[model samples]
Target: MAKKFEKIGENLEVKNIVIHQLLKDAGNRLVNPKAADNLLTIGEKEKTFLGNLDKSYHKKSSPIYGIFAEENPKFRDCLIDYINGDCQFYDFSINVMNHYKIVLENTVAATGGYMIICEYRNIITSNDLLLILMINNKEGFVIDEKSLTLDNIKNLDLSKVDVACLINLTEWVNIENNLPSERKTYLSFVKGMKEVSYYFMSFIDVDNKNTSTESTKRLITAIEAYADIEQWDRNTKINKKNKVFTYCHDCIDNKKEILLSTISSILNPDNPEHFQDFATEEAYRVSEIISGDKVRMKFLKTITYSDKEFKIEFDTKLILDNTIVLDGSGNKLTIKNISPILRDKIKELSNKNA
Candidate 1:
């Protein structure tokens, strides 16, 4: 009955800000500036906290804490592996991400159209081809990047991207500086992205402003639309008789009337309460496609644990917030152990599963 929206909780706020600042700051020195000053102010005794020394950042008496920053994502062949490790995901003790300064400009040069930025967990290159193969045609994957070009990548199937990503450039860049933000003549044109996945757009250095951040906030209406739900308050509707109002006079008569529309049987009463439920259902469908029950269970349970922790420690919206719903049956199953194959099976369902 409520017009649901995703809320970014407090726990993720600091890290989210830090990551953005890190990207924004790029390779600039963390000395004498406000970002540095803020850190130094809070960490008078922790000069090495924000500094780039990987080895000495976290000494026993050091105040510089970066939970899970030390994780070797290469070990996360699947999302299930990360989830299986439990609270270890939040232990940001180090920044193990590789910078793209080596080939940053070249990669960007290769891009000629609107594209999303994909932050790979571990595997970047070969995985892109393998993912394309699975999503479109198994034969589309060309592991040999020797002859690969942006044009070739454009021609390949991109429906199956398996990573954490942020989208950008929704128009062709053959002519930059001017673009129709809402519409494009191209067939691949899509507007207002509502989800995240993994894919490498290019390698960018730590000091590059072009580098994309990981966390992206999605709205409830936008999410429902992606799930193909029938009724979500996305468009601002107006009545001819009283056109300035977003809702008709009937809604003015009853405060709850407008709110009820989101869940109204007139729209789709049978629809699940949360947007993540739509995602979870998609995961189930993917699990069916992948035919891996153990993997599915592990993915769901791992997310459940993470969600629980987020809710307890930060009161932030879990990725599964009202958007995700576990049925009575799903709620009952608990996984104690999971295998890599099972994890991949989960990845086949959703990014969190992998």
Candidate 2:
């Protein structure tokens, strides 16, 4: 959100003047007819020129540049829009700016001050470039890459660089301070969780069958806790509960295999295949229930409460309507009902127990 630069000094300053000359020389190499016609692509040429520029001028630091070619159609279009003045500079800079910012942040943090020069080159159709300079002093500049021709380079003034287009990175200095404290904390936490999850998923994929049952149990517990907290947060009457429901429903549907396998051993102590069959059947039954179809069911034991015997009924409409409920404490409750035919089984069990 911060601008790229924070300050502007007098035009024709020594560093600016020297850098302008260096840029001109680099531009000349970039536009060389022979070099352009070489087997190496434009991107490679641009990269090579930038590499040389770093070696010749900024021996202590190297500039970074990214080339978006015809293969990268989206970025190529964005670059065209930027050159035609249809898009803002930031729009064209999105792909590379974050990486540059990260590099600058680390460099500045380590050495207390740093300067990074980078470029974005678009050669999908024709060669186009944008120059970016970032400094720790809260000042930076953007230059028209096309303006750096052999003839005009001699008269170019860097100090008078578009001060308005300058990037302000003061917010990036302490990246933690750039956003609302709570939001920043939440984002950092979520990012860390995603990184951990990525590694864990990779590990699980490698040894899914032999993965520790305890680890699977812990993962299930964590997932349940997250779901519980998220549901509670969205339980407010004004909250968009449907969005949360749809998100969770989609997640379950997408990850059904992983979820089923995770608890397969526990669900079927003796026969995992049986558990898998039951899971598949139940999934189909759930779909039918959701579609308002009266699905056939088997008898299960009835539940007795307070000395009163009650046979559970799997009335499709009732099951679907009362599938999810918010309790007094705002906890989400899922109700599973037994089929009407379970009454006879319950009576038989009670008589046998008596």
Candidate 3:
């Protein structure tokens, strides 16, 4: 894989700077006075402040943080350790970094990114959510609730959801001080916006009915295509052969050579720790691309071969560990060895591209 980032190298540098700066600040140096406004500000900005550090700052890591908070409280304890200086960012930062590293490795980037997005939304809602959103980035889920939609959402599986945000977008969520006329319109708007976001993020929500239709085939086609056509440098790329790839604690030995040999050469790796993030991001970029409505529509990629033309849809994982068997009925025949047909169709498409 072409390395496009070095998160640990980038973050450790930022963490060191943050701690050094935290120690220097007027109030943080004095005490953790819960009541003192200046002292409390540290905690307020602690997560967000630490957030400003990742090399891929927008890489989306909130799920990693949340899962750490949920599954291993020890990770949170590790944060306390940082406060105590038991873990130094320069040397042992890698050891302490394991806490977050574990979470990031297990969870998908979109999930983490969504979590951060939700919490940040929650933070906004903590304040008045009804303004013109003129004071942007100030409080919880800043939204223009006036324009929202939920009519087109079909009964589908909402399992792929990364986060569930309860946005009080309606005028009902407004402050009680507002007059009835102004409040009514705002409440209606919030309801609409919330519904739209809910369905939008719930990408793979396949309802049982939809699952049985041509749509199911369409959906899987969308998923695999998205995975195949992502954003990494293809020259140095090594596509995972239908298997899970885990993170390595140590740096790769031949990263530079192997990467430079192929299309992956576009990425640089002066700092090696970023390999995981880069590979994952590239996968996701491809995923989002293939998942687009137009791209997904191609998942079924209809083909013309010999005198007959048929749809050539393939999913790498759908059939595994066993041979495919053809089933026949009174008026129907199903065949399993479709590889040759698929290869031929792909070759045909290649000719067109050429």
List TM-scores for all candidates, in order: 0.18, 0.17, 0.19
For model 1, how does the per-residue alpha-carbon lDDT over 1-354 read when each residue is reduced to its tens digit?
533423211111111111101121224322111111111122211112112111111111101001111233331223224335542322211121222222222242221112111111112111110000111112444221222211122222223222222212222221133644332211111111112111122221111111111101112232334334434332321111122122322332231112222322223335534433442253322110011111111112212134634431111122235334345787543332457997888788897655
- Badly placed stretches (over 4 Å) of model 2 are 1-174, 179-243, 247-354
**Using TM-score as the measure, what is the rank order of every candidate, best first?**
3, 1, 2
- Distance from true location, Cα of 207 in model 3, Å: 29
lDDT of 3: 0.25
lDDT tens digits, residue span 19-126, model 2: 121111111222111011111122432343333332222221111111122332443354447557786544445433333233324332221112122333222212
Which candidate gets the maximum TM-score versus the true structure? Answer: 3
- TM-score head-to-head 1 vs 3, winner: 3
lDDT rank, highest first?
2, 3, 1
How many clashing residue pairs are found in candidate 1?
Answer: 33
List the candidate 1 regions with Cα displacement exceeding 4 Å: 1-156, 159-218, 221-327, 330-354
lDDT of each: 0.22, 0.27, 0.25
Question: Which regions of candidate 3 deviate over 4 angstroms?
Answer: 1-75, 78-308, 316-354
